[model samples]
Target: MDLPQSQLVAAHVQECNFVQIIEGLVDSSHLGFLHIDTLRKSDSSDLAYAQNVNSMQHALAPKIGVEDTAFGFYYAALRDIRKEGESRLQARVAGFIAPFTVLNPNGDLHQLVIPMTDTRSMFIHVYSASRRRSTRSRYAVSTCGWWAWTARHCSDFT
Candidate 1:
């Protein structure tokens, strides 16, 4: 877990269950809904965050593609976007390690789920990310806070 390019400048902890936290991590579809204000479509000019509209609005349904890897599997979430009058595809890739670890293809973000007890869990996240270029979640604040907060336990699913 050593990246010469980056070092731990700081760290913190937040309130979330081990199961629910991972659930939210893999459930990329909720970005449009859960993070509507943040991840939702912004404008036509920004091609980096384009959208694929359907009958209702910009559709965020990603075409998930997975490939087996030595560690586990790597996956790509491809989304169609429109520019001018043409349609194009944008892909975001990420990889998972067995047990509970996820890495962004860019190598800028990493998250691990560590269970503290039956009800509390710790999300140890590392990022060498720039705010302007990185896609951060609203939940990021909690993942880096030291306060002893607790989220509803959803470990029953495990």
Candidate 2:
């Protein structure tokens, strides 16, 4: 909740409906499958991100649990993790804020899918980290790569 340090990355997707983007955001099941290459290449040194990707990779099918809230709803993708010969359950929870905002399971990431037109949308990714820990370098590299990829493939969607 306390995000003193923040960065925003926005991408324009042509010929894509905002609702479609939101649906994709809320579907945790596709993360490992869709981004398997990225996940497989994740650096183990990158604690948080790597751990999340590892969990996702190990559990392709997670049990989904949803709960309604006044603003919108929150959902959890429950996965199994094995460590030290012991098995445990890991729950990755994310929330759908009313309108078009989504609170990612990481807690620091928030996404907004805004409609620019009936067939176009602006996808904004907000990375908000605590002041105690700086994510400047990581954020910069990630956004730069994302922008480059978007620039190269954006036309495909049109």
Candidate 3:
């Protein structure tokens, strides 16, 4: 859904909040460590995961081309899952930490973190996706698991 541009502009003007900077620090390498235990054992980082990343990068390079600059890391690795089929699905825990926006600028099923203040933050995350399930179903199952995982491991965030 498109945010009414007017609302975004208003938020920027009112000092309700301004400026959102997104940093992409996690990659396949980091995923292995960050999600190893949290994710299902079959989904953990391994030779399969690296190959998946490489395959995705290769597929996306032709369509979107490759951007090899400072801003490019964010766009890197756009995989084509159709080739992989239904064996295992890969998902990113992405987040949009914004000053005011409630919904993620990037759809659901990725980790979305919104920071309200320096020390305090609100996190909305998507845990997984499945070809077998509808969007709503995938989100419900994944979100619950994600919330439970975060509550147990991420004490600092609380």
User: Which one is best on TM-score?
Assistant: 2
How do the residues 1-158 of candidate 1 rate in per-residue lDDT, one tens digit apiece? 46544443233354556767766665555566666655444444353333321211344677889889998777777777664687877666778787788775545667787777665676667766442242233333454354332442333434
TM-score of candidate 1 to 2 decimals: 0.63
CA-lDDT, candidates in order: 0.57, 0.69, 0.31
- How close is every model to the real structure, measured as TM-score? 0.63, 0.73, 0.31
- Output the better candidate (1/2) by TM-score: 2
How much is 40 displaced in model 2, in angstroms? Answer: 1.6
**Candidates 1 and 2, the one with greater lDDT:** 2
lDDT of 1: 0.57
Among all windows of ten consecutive residues in candidate 1, which has the lowest summed lDDT?
48-57
Ranking by lDDT: 2, 1, 3
